[model samples]
Target: MYREVPSARVRGAVLWWSTSPSWTTPVRILPDGCMDLIWSQRHGLLVAGPDTTAQVGTASPGERYVGLRFPPGTGPAVFGLPAYELRDRRVPLTALWSEGRTRELDERAAYADRPERLLESVAAARLGEAGGPDPVARPLVARLDAGGEVARAAADLGLGPRQLHRRSLALFGYGPKTLARILRMQRALSLLRTGVPAADAAARTGYADQPHLSREIRALTGLPPRTLLTTTP
Candidate 1:
């Protein structure tokens, strides 16, 4: 479904594309210090922010795209975690890269120069074959998806509230509650896009009401739900 090419410039840049049969939603590509260009079947093309989180889904036919991956060292600072963990955090990728605030990592991956190289490298890596979600993050993801309360999810995971906060801050750059809210908002967006009424979507996605959902949507995308739906691409 997705193909990656290695960088030609410095062997650090990689390019990739997803061309599968299934309707792909906007993928929430987590920022791991890598820059990417995503093309969707529905959405034409998108250049990601350094640390910004996006919802990627399958587009219509003929919707294809390319991405450029930066080398480990040269890449932006990415708070390492699944997409669900970065809720409500507005830290920029450039800020992280400039301050050297993240964990010591090789952000400059060989996908930096000449993204076509990513196809080869990604083919070799076989991301599809790399089975299973991250063990540590999976439970959290599941809990959020199931609409479990953050406090309950933490308890179920055998983590104390304070401990969960610490771990979340270290791994996700945000607290667990914030991440949960983000996941809920993403789900709400999907529902809205699919013709669900805003009031219903808000209740299903855990917001206090439509107004609450509106506020969050405005904060994240700088637009209200109606505006976003009208001009998502």
Candidate 2:
């Protein structure tokens, strides 16, 4: 089965797998700035982003996998906007395959060969260094990080609530409120992982109560806070 490890840096999550059973259709997860390295017996190696959700069907039986996930601020420095957008749609790495740089990834997956080598090679290509924050996204991320109320944040940005909603959708594929919620939830998860009590984590992360935190965490991660933090990656 698939297994993962939390990154030591705490800015990201990492996962490693030895073997796993076949999975069904793709599962959709929310957008975030993380990358993955997937290896399989039938498909050798693939590196992907965390902004998109992916179907697990392509993985073959008896394969080994390792994934490195980059946190939000760290993301723009790695994969460019195209890769980020591609990952946002859960598209496969091979779909965007190129000749010189990314070809080795496709070839390795097809041949079921040593994936780590390909992982190192492709990572060295430095695709993440291309883009900067979307102009519209910057203020929103800043406001959210500063613990500003959603309505106030929008107002301070000189955007009406509805205008901010539209801009967030155009820029991040989600509304501002939804993006704010995700950012809050991510902060809560980080706090909880670092030994903060559930109640305290909720308050510090701007949740009204423990149940509020639980509900949001469940909505974003498909699991409750305790399960999410305690469960091995």
Candidate 3:
């Protein structure tokens, strides 16, 4: 079972937890322009970076995982590094923080009944020290997710194309163009989950057509639309 709740301690973040049953299945984690700080019963503490493609993950039966997912541009502030450095990777928390800090966090998580809350608290404290996420991050994501053209969005944000690209790399681990594509795919997937036909979902979400949608989905997820839906949360 899996569940997520909006984080009260950290703005624009979610706290989630999941437990594997006696039987295990591969989980498809799609790219959604976010990074996660995770605590696992089996793996200890880890960081999940933004992905350019879907990630296939599995767990030992009966294992539990708790995570705090930070929105695009929010993670760098809390993690104290550029988002691009961790893109498409999952690394031990010790890799990003000093052993002393990592060990303290591990102890806290081990003693907390709800480790996701601990993850959120840690993120909140770090983000406060960093003076919070970039002010442009939320607006940038909103503009791209709404299907605004990258150039126009940059201009609207009072940024030159190069400036936007550079900032995007640091904030989202990719350029605005790729982020837009991933956000559009997420929109299409949401529509599909609600029983929207593939063709209609494509058109509504700005794809050229059904085939265009199919191709994009397969490229990003390595699966057909139907298969992808079966694995989606």
Model 3 TM-score is: 0.97
Q: Native-vs-model 3 lDDT?
A: 0.91
- Tens digits of per-residue lDDT for model 1, 9-114: 4344566665544554543343232334333334322334334344443455445555555432222222223333333343333333333521121132222443
lDDT of 2 by residue, 10-74 (tens): 23335455554454323334445344555544444454544422223333444455555543433
Sort the candidates on TM-score, descending order. Answer: 3, 2, 1
Note the residue pairs that clash in candidate 3.
Answer: none
lDDT of 1: 0.53
Tell me the TM-score of each prediction against the true structure.
0.52, 0.59, 0.97
What lDDT is reached at residue 209 by model 2? 98
Pairs with backbone N, CA or C atoms under 3 Å apart (clashes), candidate 2: 1-19, 4-15, 26-55, 44-109, 77-128, 78-128, 79-128
- Sort every candidate by lDDT, greatest first: 3, 2, 1
lDDT of each prediction vs. the true structure?
Answer: 0.53, 0.57, 0.91
RMSD over all Cα atoms, model 3: 0.9
